[model samples]
Target: MKFFDVFLKQFRLQWRQYLVASLASYGSLCTGMSMGWTSPVLPQLRGPNSPLPEQPTLQQESWIGSLLVLGGLIGPFITVPLSKHVGRRWLIMGSNVPLLLGWLLAGVTTNLPTLYVARLAWGCATAMQFATVPIYIGEIAEDKIRGALSAFFLLFINIGFLLAYAIGPFTSYWGLTACGGIISLLYLPFSWYLPETPFFLVFKGRLEEASSVLQQLRGKTKDEVQPELDSLQAMIAREYEEEPKISDLWASRGSVKALGICVFLAMLLQLSGIDVLLFYMEELLAKVGTKISPSDGTIIMGVVQVATSCVTPMVVDRLGRKLLMWTTSLGLTIFLTLIGVYALLDNYYKYDVTSVTFLPLLCLIVYMILFTLGVGPVPWILVAEMFPLKTKCLASGICSFMCWLAGFIWTRFFRDVAASYGIYTAFWILAVCCGIGFIFSVALLPETKGKTFDEIQDLLNNRTKQGNPGA
Candidate 1:
C-alpha cells in the first residue's frame, strides 16, 4: 500500500480511538491556559485591569501562581478510585467540567476567595489529567504508535501554554479565560464518543464488547481479533486468581521497581526547574540581562517549548524512550550549569557580562529544547506503560500525586530560594538534580519502545526473562 493510503487505512477503524485521545488532550490544553494565565494576569491584577479592589501583595501574587498545586493535592483521591468504578471517559468528562467552571469563574470573579477557588479547580483538573488521560491512551493504542500518541498529551499541553503566552498579552484576562472554557466545550464531544478500553471491558467480563472494540480499534475482522480477546480473558482470569492488594503494591519486587522508576522520573521532571523557568520567566529574564523584553522572552520561550516538544511525537517510537530520557536529562544538566555559571558571575561577583547579554537567552532556549525532547513527556508515558493492569490506576494516581506534591513544594518555595540565595543557586540546584536524573535514568529506566501492553507488563514483571531486553 502507498504510505498515504496506509495512513488513511490505519485511521479508518481507529479514528474514534484517535479522536478520543485528541479530545482528552483538550484538558491538557486548558491546563496550559491555567499555567500561562497567571504570568499575564498577575501583572493585570497588580494594576487595575480587573475588578480586584486593590493590587495584590507579593505574598498573594506568589499564592496565585502556586495555588493550583493545592487543588492537585485533592484530585487523584477523587478520580483514582472513581475512574476504576465509573470509567475513564466519564472521569475525563467530569474532570474537564471543573476546568470549564474554573476558567469561567476566573473570567468573571472579583473576590479573592473566589479566585482562589478557581485556581484550585484548575489544579484538580490538571491532577486528573495526569491520572486518567494517559491510562486511557495507553490502553487503547497499539505499541508501535503508542509513543507518538502519548506525546500528543504533552503536545496539547504545550500548545495550550503557548496559546496563553501568545494571546494572553493581547487579550483581557477575562477573554483569555473565556478561550479556556471554549477548549473544554470543544473536547466534550470527543470524550462523549470514546470507547472503554478492551482491557477494561474484558476485565469486567464483557468479552463480546471487548472483542468488538478490539476489532474496531485494530481494523481487523472478528476472527483476527478473537486471539486478542482470548489473551485478555486469560489475563483477566489470572488477575482474578491473584488480585493485588493496595497495601501490597510494594511487596512484589517488580512492582516496587516499576513504581520507583515512575516516582523518580516524576521528581526529576519538576526538579529540572521547568516550572520556575516558566512561572518566573519575566523576572528571571530581566534579572539575567536577557536582551529581549520579558514579555517577548516569555512568548519566545513558550514558542520554543512547543516547537521542540513537537519533535517527540515524530521521533519517539523511532528513536525510543531511553535515548530521549538520558540524553535530554544530561543536556539539561549542561545548559542549566551554563545558566548558573553565568548568573553567578553576573549576580554575586559583580562581573559585567553585558556584552554576553544573549548568553542567558541562548541557554534558556537550549534548556527548553532539551527538556521537550524527552523529560517533559516520557515520565508520563512511562507511568502509563510500566504498571500491571491490576495496579495501573492506583500506581498512576499515586505517582501523579507525588509529582504534584513535588510541584507544589517547588512552586511554593523556589521564589524564596531565588530571593534569598540568588537565581544562580536555584540554577545550580536544578543542574545537579538533572545530572543525577540523567545517571539514574540511564542506569535504570527500562525501554518500552515497541512492546504491546502484555509484553510491557511481562518485561516489567520479569516473566519473559530475555535477560533484560532493553539492555
Candidate 2:
C-alpha cells in the first residue's frame, strides 16, 4: 500500500512531464520502426505483384536502403545545433512534419525514385527526433526519477518496434501509411502540452517562465520550486562563467576523449548485429530454418524486445551502466558464437540437422533478450548522461552521426556478406565484434551510477588523473 501510494504520488507530480517525454520518446520509436517495419515488406514491394512500379533487382534495392541510412547519418549534424539555437520543443515538433510527408509520399507513389526520396526524407526526420528526445527528457526530469523516466524512453522504443513488427507483416502500404499518420497526429497535441525545458528557458533569460515551467513539472508550489530553481541558475551561471566555445569540444583533451568515447560506444552498439536482427528478422529466421510466417516472427521478436526493455529500467541504476554493458556484450558474443556454430552444422556439417537448426533459433531469441537488456538501453543512457552541459548538444550530434554511419555500413554490407560468406560467417564476424566491445567496456567505460550531471562533468574532465583516457 505504501509503495502504491508513492507510485501514485510520483505519477501525479510528474504526469505532465511524463506525458511529454513518453510522446517524444514514442516519436523516435515510430520513426525507427517505420523504416524497420518496411524492411520485411521490401521484397514484396519489389516483386512483380507489387502495386507500385516494376521491381528492381536486389542490388538496386540495397542501394536504395543505403540512401535512407545515409540520410540518418547526415541529419543529426544538421538538427542538433538547430535545436540548441531554436529550443527543443520546436525542433522536435518540426521533425514530425517530414516524417508525415515521407509516409504520405511512400504510400501513394507509383515510381521507385519517388519512394526512395520519401524514405530519405523519413530517415532524416527520424534521426532528428532520436537526437533531440533524450536531451529534452534529461533536461526536464527531476534527479530522483531521472533514470526511471529515461528508461521509459527505451520502453516506448521497444513498444514501437513491437507494433511495427506485428503490423508490418499484415498491413499493406496504405495501412502502414495510415499508422504513420496516426503517430503524426498524436505528436501535435502531445507536444503542445510539453513545458519548455527549464534549462533552455533560463538560458534565454526567461527566469519567470523557467520557474513556472519547473514548478509545473515538479507539481510543486513556488516555495517548493525555489530551491531547485536557484540550484539550476547557479549551475548554468557556472557553466557559462568560462564562456564555453564550440571549439572546446575538440580542443581540450578531456572533451576530445569524451567525444571519442561516445562515438565508439555508438558504433559498437550498431555493429553488434542487433539491427541486422531487427531489420531482417523474418529473413534471418528463415535462413536458420525457422520458417514461421513473417507476421508471427515479428510478433515474437516484438514481445521479447518489450519484455527485456521493461527489465532494464529496474536494473540499470542498481547494477550500474558499466556492468550492464559488459554483461550484455558478453552475452551477445556467446549467443552469436553459438548461432554461428549451429548455422555451420546445419548447412555444412549436416550432422543432426534438425537439432542444429532449432538450436540456432533458440539462440537468436536469447540474443534478442540480451540485446534489449544491455545494448539497447545502456548505450542511449550513457550518451544522455556522459556529456557536460557545455558540449552535450554538439557531442550528441557527433555521436548520433557515428551511430547512423555504423548503421549504414552494417545494412549496406550485411546482405552481401550473407550472400558471399554465408549467414554463419556473418554471425561469426558479429561475435568477434561483440568480443572486442566487451574489452572496450571494461577498459574504457566509466561508472556513472548515482552521479549528478555536474559530478559526471568533473569525472569526465579528470580523465587523465583516473588513468583512463576513454573516461
Candidate 3:
C-alpha cells in the first residue's frame, strides 16, 4: 500500500482509540506538571520573597519533592481493588478529584502541612493514572499500534513537564497552580465520555457492553467487531475461569516472569535518576554553573524532552522495544558519565573548565532526550503489554508502586548525597545505574513490539526459543 493510504486506513480504524487514549492521558499530563512543579517553585519558596509563611528549609523542600512519590505508594492498593469493581474508565475519571484538589490547595495554601497534603494528593492521583491509563490503552488499542498508544502515557507526561517548565518560570505561584487545577478540572468532563475498556467490561460480565465498546474502539460495525469480541471473551473466560486472586499474578511461569521483568524495569527507571533531574532541574543547572539561567535551562531541556518523547511513538514499533531500550540506556550511561566527570573536575578539582562550561547542560539536555526515548516510556508500556487481562491491574499497580518508591527514596536523599559527597557523586551513581540498565536491556529485556498478549506470554514462558524468535 502507498504510505499515505496505509496511514489513512490506520487512522480511520484507530482514531477513537487515539481520542480516548489522549483523553485518559491528560491525567498523565497533569501528573507531569505536578512532578515538574517543584523544579521552579521550590527555589522561589526558598527565596527572599517566599510565598509560604516562611522560607522552606532544605529538609522541607526535600519533603515537598519526595512526598509526591511517597503518596504513590498507596496508589496501587486503592486502584487495584477499585479498578476491578468501578472499572478502569471511572477510576481514571475519579483520579481527577485528587489532582484537582491537589492543585487547588497548592495554589492557595500558606502552611507547610497544607502544601504537603497537596503534594500527597498529586501523588495519589499520579499512582492512579499510572495504574489505569496504560492498561486501558493497552486493551483498547490494536496490537499493531498498542506500543504507540501505550507510549502516549509518557508522551503526554513530557508535554506536561514542558508546560510546567515553560509556565512555572513565568507565572506567579498561584498562577501556576491555577493552570494545573484548570487542566485537572477540564480533564474530568471529557473523561465521562470515554468508553470503558472492553477487557474490563467482559471481565465484569457486561458482554454486550464490551462488544459495543470494542466496536466503538475499532470503528467497526457490530458484525466486523464480532471476531475480536469473541477473542476477548475466550481470553477473559480462560483467564478468569477461577476467580482471579493476587496469587493469580504468578499462576503461570510466564505471568511470574512478566511481573518480575516489569518490577525490575520500574525500579531501574526511577533509580536511573530522572526524578533528581526533574525535581531539581533548576538547582542542578545552577550548581553546574551553566551560562544559561536555571529556569531557562529547564525550559530548554523540557523542550528537548517533549520533542524527543514525540519521536518514540513514531519509531517504537518500527525499531522494537529491546533495541530502543539498549540504545537509550547506553546513551544515558555515556551522557551521565560525561555530566559526572564535568561536575567532578569543575566542582572538586576547581579546574578552569570555562572552555567546556557548556558540557553539563549539553549532557543534561541529551540525557533528557535519550531518557524520553526509551527508559522513560518503555517500562510503562511493558507494564500494560506483558500481563494477562485477569491480573493486569494488580501487576501494573505493583510496578507503578515500585517505580514511585524508588523515585521517593532516590529524590529524597539526592540533596543529602550531593551535600555529603559531591554533586558528581550523584551523577556517577546514576551513570553506574544506567550502565547496569544497559546490561539488563541486552540480557533480560524481551521484545514485545507488535506481539499479541498470548504470543508475549508464550515468549516469556520460553515456549518458542529459536533465536528468541521474535527478538
Candidate 4:
C-alpha cells in the first residue's frame, strides 16, 4: 500500500488511539508552552513600571523561581504513584484543572504572594502532564511506531513554544493568560475521548479491554489482536515478576549508570541556556543594541522555533540519537560562542552597525536551528527509552524533576546574571555548558535508535552482570 493509504487506513481503524495520543500529547505540550510564555515576562512583571511591589529584589525573583522548580520536584513524587493506582487518562485530564485556574489567577492577581501561588499551582499541573503523557504514549503505541509517536511530545512542545512566543509580546498579560485558559479548555474534550493506555489496562488484568484497544490501535481484527495481546501480557508478566525496587536504582551498577546518564542528559539540555534564550529574548536583543521591538523579536523567535522543530522527526531515527545530539551541541556551542564574542566586540571595540546587527542575529538563528534538531528532542527520547520497565516511572520522574529544577535555576538567575555579568558573559557560560554536554554525549551516552524495550533491558541487565561478576 502507498504510505498515505496505510496512514489513512490506520487512522480509520485506530482513530481512538490516535485521538487519545494526540490529546494527551497536546495537553502536555500546552502546559509546557504556557510555562515558556512566562520566561520573557518575568523581568517585566517585576520591573519598576510594573504594578506589583518593589520590596523583593532580583534575589527574591530567583527565590520565586525556585518555587516553580520546587513544584516540579514535588509533582512526580505525588503523581507517579497515583498513576499506578488510578490511571494515566484521568491523572492527565485532571491536571488541567489547576493549570487553567493557575493562569487565570495569575493574570488577575496584583499581590506577589498570590502570583507565586498561581505559579506553583501551574507548575504542579505541568508536572502531572509531563509525568503521565510519555508513559501513556509508550504503553499505547505498537513497537514499530513507538519512537515516531513519542516524538510527538517534543513536536507539540515546540508548537506550544512558537504559539506562546508569538502571542506573548503582542498582547497584555491578561490576554496571554486568557490564551492559556483557551488552551486548557482542550483538555476537557480530550479526557472524554482518550482511551486508557493498553499497558495500564493489561496491568489491571482487564484482558478484554486491552484486546479491544490493541485491535483499535493496529487496525486489526480479533484474529490479529490475540498475538499482540499475548506478547504484551507475557512482557508485562515478566516485568512484574522481576520488578526492580527504587533501591535497585542506585544499588545496581547498570541502573545507577543509566540514572546518571538520564540526569546528566536532562541537566545538560536545560543548562545549555536555551530556556534562558527563549525566556529572555527581548532582554538579550536589547542588550546587543538591536532596535527590534519585543513584539517583533518574539514573533521572529516563534517562527524560528517552529521551522526548526520540523527537522527533528524526519532525521531523528535516521541520524541516531547520539550523533544528532553531539552535532547539535557542538554547533550550538560554536554559534553561541561566536555570538558572545561579537557582542563583546560590539561593546568593547565599537564595530559598525552592519557587522554588529546582522551577524549576531544570524548566529542566534543558527543556535535555534541546532537546538531544535538535536538537544531539544533527544533528551526526552533517550530518557523515555533508557530505563527498564520496572524503573521507568521512578527514573523518568527523577529525570524530569532535575530538568525542571535546572529550568528554575536558569530562569531565576539569567536576568540577574545578564544584569551583573553582561549578556555576552552569560552566553559564554552557556557555550561552555554546551561544550561539556558534547563531551558527555560522546564519552558516556549509548546509541538507542532502532532498539526495542526488551533489547534495551537485556543490554542493561547484561551490563549489570558483567560489572558485578557475581550476580
Candidate 5:
C-alpha cells in the first residue's frame, strides 16, 4: 500500500488519540505564533508606517526582545507548581488566556510599556507550553507511536513559524495580532474534547477514572487493558511508596542519570549555535563575504528547517533517536568547523577569501537541516520519556527551567563572547562544543524509539526487569 493509505488505515484505529495530539500540538502552534509575530511586527513598528508617533529606540527594541526571556525565566514558577496539583489539561488551556490577551494587547496599543507587558505574558505562555505538552503526550501515547507523536510538538512549532513568516509580512498590524487570538479561541474546544492523560489520573489516585481514560486511549476492552492498567498502578504505587524526600538538587542516582541526559540534550540544542544561525544569519553571512542577502539567507535557512522537520516523524521510529542525534551532532561539528575555518582565514590570517564565500552559506544550510532532523525535536521527546512518575512533575519542571536559563545566558553572552574574542573564535567555540557533544551523546544518550514509559524509567532506576509486553 502507498504511505498515505497505510497511515490513514492506522489513523482509523487511533484517531481519538490523535485528537489528544492535536490538543497538545496547539501549544506549539501558540508558541510559534508568538515567535513569528516578533520578526514582522518589530519592523512595522519602526518603519515609515510606524504604529506609534515615535519609533522605539535601539535600546528599547533590545529590551523588548530580552523581556520575553526575563518573563520566561519566571513563567515556569507558575506552571511547575500549578501543573503538579491541578493537572496538565488546564495549565495548557490556561496558557492560552495569556496568548489571547498578549496579542489583543498588541492589537489595541502601540505603547512600549504595554508591549513590554504583552511580550512578558507571551513568554509565560511559551514556558507553560514547554513544561506541560510533552509530558501529556508521553503519558497518553502508546509506545509504538510515542516518538512520532511527541514530535508533533515540534512539527507544529515550525508550522506556526512558517505560517507567521509567510502570512505576517502581508497582513496588517491588527490582523497580525488577530492571528494569535484566532488560534487561542480555536484551541478551547479542541482541547476540551481530549481526555486527561491516564498517568495524571492514576497519580492522583483516581484509579477508576484512570482505567476509563486508558480504555478510551488504548481502544481496547477493559479485560484487554487490565495488564497495562496494572503496570501503571504498580509504577504509581512505587513512586508514592513514601512521600518523596527532596534530595539536594533533587538528586537520586536514577534522576541524576536522567538529568545528565536532559542537560546534554539541552546543551546540544542551544550550543550547537542554532541561535547564532537564526538570529544573526545575515550578519554572519556578511562577515563571510557571501553575496547572499541576509533576508534570502534567512529564508533559505527557514525553508530548510521546515523541510527537515517533516523528515523526523516519518523516520524517527524507523531509524531511532540515538543514530539521528549522533549523526546530526557530528554533522554540526563538521559544518561548524568549515565555517569557523573560513572565518579564521578571513579575519586573522588576512586571506581575502572571497572565492570560497559560498562555503560558509553552504555549511549553514546543511548544518540547519541536520540540526532540525535531530537536535531540534529529540531532546523534548527524551525529556518526556525518561522520567519516572514520582519525579515526572518536578523533574520536567527543573529540566525545562534549566533550558530557559541556558537559552537566556547563551543569547545574552554570545555577542560579548564574539566581540571580545572575534566571530571566528565564537564559531570555533560552538564547533568545539558540538564535537564534545557528539562524544557525550555516543557515551550516554538513551535509545527510546520503541520503549514503554515503564521500561525507560526502569532503565533510569538501573533495575533489570522486562517491561510489560503490551507497553
Candidate 6:
C-alpha cells in the first residue's frame, strides 16, 4: 500500500516524464530481442531445419553470437560525436534503420555469411540504443525518480527477452524476424512524438525551448520550471567552461578515478556471465539436465528476469546503489558457486543426481532474480550518473566499448572453454568474478542514489569527504 502510494504520487507528479522515458526505453526492448534471438535460433540453425545451405561450424556459431558484440563496438563511436551534433532523440530514432535492416536481412538471408552480416547490423543498433537510452532518460527525469526511470531501460530489455523466449520456439524463422521488424516499426512512429530532452536543448543554447520542454516534462508552468531550467543552464555553463573534450576525462584525479570505477563496473557486468547466459541459456539448461525442456526453462528464466527487474525501479533510491550491488553480488557468488558444485558433482563425478535435478533450475531462477535486481541494471544507471554532461558521451562510449569487448571475448570463448574443461569450470569462473565484484563493492564503490551531478562530481573528485568505503 505504501509502495503504491508513492508510485501514484510520482505518477501524478511526473506522468509526462514517465511516458517519455518509457518510449526511449523501447529501444532497449529491441536490443533485448536481438540479444535473445541467438539462444532459440542457434539450436534451429545447427539442427536439421537450418535456413542456411550448410550448418555453421562451432567456430561460426561463436562468431554468430560474438559478432553482435563486435558490431556494438562501433556503436559508442557513432553515438559519441553524433549525439552532440544531432541530439539523443534523433540518434535514437536513426537506430531503427539498422535495427529494421538487420532483422529484415536475417529473415531473408539464405547463407551463413549473410546471416553473420545481419547479426552485426543488429548488434550496431543494440549498442546505439543502449548508449543513448540511459542518457536520454537520465537527462529528462527528476532526481527523485531518475533511478526508477533508468531501471525501466533494463526492465524493457528483459521484457524483450521474455518476448523472444516465449515466441521464438513456436515461430518460424521468418515469423520471428518479422516480429522484430514490426517492433522497430512501432518504435519509429511513436518515438517521433517524443520531446527533445531539455538538457540537450539547453546545451544547444535553446533555453526558451528547453523551458517549454521542461514544462511538458514536469507538468509545470514556465514559472514552476524556471528554477530547474536555470539549473540546467548553470550545469551546461559549468560543463562548457570545463571544455568537455575527451582529454577532460583524465584532466583531474577525480575524473580519472570516476572513469576507472565506471570501467571496472562495466567489465564486472559482462564478466559476471550475463552474455553467456543471454547467448546460451537454453544450452546451459540442457546441460543442467532439468526436468523441464530447455525452451521452457529459457522462457521461465526470461519471465523471472522481467519480474525481478521491476524491483530495482521501486527501491533503488530507497536502498541505494552500493547496498544493492553488495547484496546481489554476494547472492550471485553463492548461487553461481552452488551451480558450479552441482555441475562438478553431476558431470565430473558422474553422480546420479536425478532426485536433485531441481537444484540447477532453482539456483538459476534466484541468479536471474538477483542479477536483474542489481548487476543487470545498476551499472547502466551508474554510467548515466557518474560523469558530467561534457564528458558523458566520451565516458559512456568508452564504458560501452569496454563492456561489449569483454562480453565478446567471454561469449566467444565460453563454448571452447566449457568443451575443453567442464561446464563446471565455466560456472566456477563466473562465480569468482561475482566474488570479486562483491569485494569491489565493499572496498571502493561509491553511492549516488539521490545525488545531483555536482554532488556526484564532488564525491568522485574528493572535494567532499564520504565515509570510508572499507569501513
Top candidate (TM-score): 6
Relative to the true structure, how large is the alpha-carbon lDDT of every model?
0.81, 0.76, 0.87, 0.74, 0.75, 0.88
Mark the 10 consecutive residues where model 3 has the least summed lDDT. 462-471
lDDT of 1 at 216: 78
Write down the TM-score for model 6.
0.97
lDDT of 1 by residue, 1-471 (tens): 475475567657567666657877777887877877787777778666775888888778778778887788788897777865787777888886778878877878888888988988898988888888888888888777788778889888888878888877788878888887887777677667778888888877788888888887787989998987887788778766775578656867778888999998987888888777776677788877677888888899889988887777767776778888999999999989989889889888989898898999989999988888789889999988888777888888888888888887888888788889998888888999999999997788778888776776677777875333233
TM-scores vs. true structure, each candidate:
0.93, 0.92, 0.97, 0.89, 0.87, 0.97
Ranking by lDDT: 6, 3, 1, 2, 5, 4
Q: For each candidate, C-alpha RMSD in Å?
A: 2.6, 3.0, 1.7, 4.4, 3.7, 1.7
Better of 4 and 5 by TM-score: 4
Per-residue alpha-carbon lDDT of candidate 3 for residues 140-164, written as tens digits (9 for 90 to 100): 8899998888888888999888899
| Structure candidate 1, residue pairs in collision | none
Encode model 6's per-residue lDDT on 130-243: one tens digit a residue. 789888999999998898999999999999889889888998777787888888788888779888889899999998999999888888899999999998888888778855
Candidates 1 and 6: which is better by lDDT?
Answer: 6
lDDT of 4 at 127: 75
lDDT of 2 at 293: 61
Error at 341, model 4, angstroms: 0.8
Write candidate 2's Cα lDDT for 1-471 as tens digits: 675577668778678777767876767676766666555567567666565767777676666566666778767866766865788888888877777777787777887878778778877886786677788888898765666667777777778778777777677766766786776668677767667899888878889999899877877888888888888889888877785677878866557767877788888878998767777777777776554665676678788878887766656665777887888899999999988887777776766766444566678778878877777777677677877676777778888888889988987798799889888999999999999989988888777776778767667777323322223
Query: Higher TM-score: candidate 1 or 3?
Result: 3
Off by over 4 Å in 3: 1-9, 466-471
Task: Select the stronger candidate by TM-score from 3 and 6.
Answer: 6
Global CA lDDT computed for model 1:
0.81
